[model samples]
Target: MCGIIGIVSHSAVNQELYDGLTVLQHRGQDAAGIVTSDGRHLCLRRKNGLVKEAFRTSSHMRKLKGKMGIGHVRYPTAGSSSQAEAQPFYVNSPYGISLAHNGNLTNSSSLQRELFEQDRRQINTESDSEVLLNIFAQELHHQNSYRVTPDDIFKAVAGVHKRCKGAYAVVAMITRDGIVGFRDPHGIRPLIYGARKTEGGIDYMLASESTSLVTQGYEVVRDIMPGEAIYITHDGEVHTKQCAENPTYNTCLFEYVYFARPDSVIDNVFVHKARMRMGHKLAEKVQNEWKDHDIDVVIPIPDTSRTSALEMAMTLGVSYREGFIKNRYIGRTFIMPGQKQRKKSVRQKLNPIDLEFKGKNVMLVDDSIVRGTTSKEIVQMVRDSGAKKVYFASASPPVRYPNIYGIDMPAANELIAHDRTEGEIAELMGVDRLIYQDLNDLKDSITEGNNELVEFDCSVFNGEYITGENKAYFDELQQKRADSSKKKKNKRAAVDMCNSQ
Candidate 1:
């Protein structure tokens, strides 16, 4: 849900970090930050905006001049949008440490309560990053060490990992040595490392996505293994340690379906290839089910679904057309502020090209339909552009369940396809026919020879939650939601009674 990067080079690494963050800007647009270690001190700057808007002037980049640094672009998961919630969160005590993190921690509420009860440490922000920083600080204080070696760092992180549950990919900067990166045991999120070939020597770079590294002239080494930690010293010495003994690889499937850029790769699997496979599988299903009908053209919704559309076009033996032109200036419609704004934004976000759709029986390819709002708008747009008939093809199965893992999907009742049949959904969207990728088909697409290219966390699709070592935390979350709903109902009743009086 966020992007993180770190760099260690013989020369100043400000520019490299800046460019890497730019490549990762798509992962998050809410906030951007960077912390550079100048050996003597860590220069930090963070704000709520895009990378270009946040770091507008040369003076902003010049302030962070150091051989090693860490950067983050944040998408708010738990906390309210504010300057304090923005990351590269620093703790001054025990050797001035700054940390940036991606992914959500399910046990954070429990851990926060425990930390507050044990030690009178007031957490300033609601973000789990601050909780993580405080936990590391507490461990350092408990060990009572000043040297803060790599071993000490690993032990501190392991202690926090034992207490914490859920996903996290972290990058931290220390005053003395340099940058360190770590991924959660389940590997629900992604983190990769790259090395730039410099004139003097090699520079190490760590990022949430590989495209960032490629943009900054660094060749990707590999994805940082799940439950693994790597520390890149100021002198370019890379030290690694494993935090979790037997790690489960539960890479998020939504990343391939929607979140990640097509150019990025995760867990040794190319994102674009995975999407293409999904499209091909969908095409096969459609051919099997609706053999009588003819699909004249396969038209992509633009941007994210283009790769899948191309594969669908080839599979169906239909010509592929760029039917929709996306407005490059607007933010993503899904992440817009409100439903009203998102509905209005969708019109501005995409426009159907009349030449491509006129008199054509178009099959519109898209990744997924969450609430079906955007799909309905797009279907109407295509029909208005003179398409004879519109057939909608979703590359992924219907999202009938809620995504508790950081994706901002609404509750099950709010999902359009959750209760409605495919025929009903097709009528609601005003499409001639609608086809969704089957769940089994999606699973089959990613299967290789005795090995899956990526292990998927499809809890949202199947309603089968994979309980990790931290099963108790899942129970706690369910209970908490129940209590919150009860409390809201009670408050509403009280307010109504008072008004009646």
Candidate 2:
């Protein structure tokens, strides 16, 4: 998944966009980009790397002078890790639009062909996001309006909703008109817009998470509804419209389980509260199944799992301890593009504390076990830390399928739980016992707080594509990932040989 932000303020928003990207940096680590529009000109700066590294120099900051802007932090799920694929992709013909997108489009291959042949547009990168931007641009071009209005923008978004069949939450800026934001019909990705009162008028911001707006002192108006489009004019006027035919609320379940910050609220559900509920639900399962278990201390796997682990420990009546110390310098291993990178970073990401594990039965809690690489490493670390016995608990259910809606686990074989039984996975990870949260319980945890959210995009757990059955898409995705993996391996071998010489 990626993080996207848009702002229409009274003053230059380059600094605020940069600051906002840093806050949402956890969502993506591979690349960061920002585009600002001063009504007359659009200044853009984007590169492969973290937000700070991309915009480190004052010169880079100085060039981005505008009252309205859009920013993106991206980790590739659709494209290769190259500077050419960096976001805020621009198309000059369609009113000079620059767009940033979160989530993946399943119908991108067909759309790519359609764009090149039918729509007469060229796609420069493998990124589906660029395809999405072009689709929007083409739709806008179809509007044929010299002066694009909010209604025209909404119509363009409706066309986008009709053709694009997957998950997408977009923020696009028209050079002189306005900044536009829209979500896919199923609302599989998060998007929220808020405003703050200022002397010049109301300054508005649209972002992937509420934390970005709240942290910047903007009062949350509400989440942009499923299939809704919001337009904030350069002069600070706001307009919104429902752009989909039959929109459904199917926010990605993984966001609540792992991606989102605890402080943020999406679809009226507090992330921290939902995670606490996940802990309580998992605790109930543990109590019923393993009443005689010897889980002396509950230790979280650092960061995201801490909230759930704390609540689980209290419910299980076990001592809660910080068994692992995390190095703040490392990015999230799960979001790392390659298996080698993820494997190498796991140990660097966290170090086991001998005092917490020494002579104790330690129960380790993690958000979820995806590839099992990190889980295996952490279990080994705990063993090396003198633990008597090691038990593992996942706050979420097993990820048995690929997440086509923007998570990087596209191949079934890459998922530890895809074809393996819980017992088998437990043995493979070297854990004495493994307890996974049930799918029903996971749904309950998020919906308990907000009954309005009845549906979720849990494709990773159930293999149920929300848009429709995309067997062909899945087949193509698997093949692409396999080819990419092979290419990376061969490239690494060539690099090793060169270094030896």
The candidate that wins on TM-score is: 2
Q: For candidate 2, lDDT tens digit of each residue in 272-297?
A: 99999999888999999998988999
Residue 430 error, candidate 2, Å? 0.8
**Clash count, predicted structure 1:** 0
List RMSD in Å for every model shown: 5.7, 2.9
Stretches > 4 Å off in candidate 2: 337-340, 483-501
Candidate 1 on 184-285: residue-level lDDT in tens? 877778999998777888899999999998988889998887788888888888888987767778877788788888888877777878888888888888
Tally clashing residue pairs in candidate 2. 0
Evaluate model 2: give its TM-score: 0.96
Candidate 1, residue 191: the lDDT equals: 92
Candidate 1 clashes between residue pairs 3 or more apart in a chain or in different chains: none
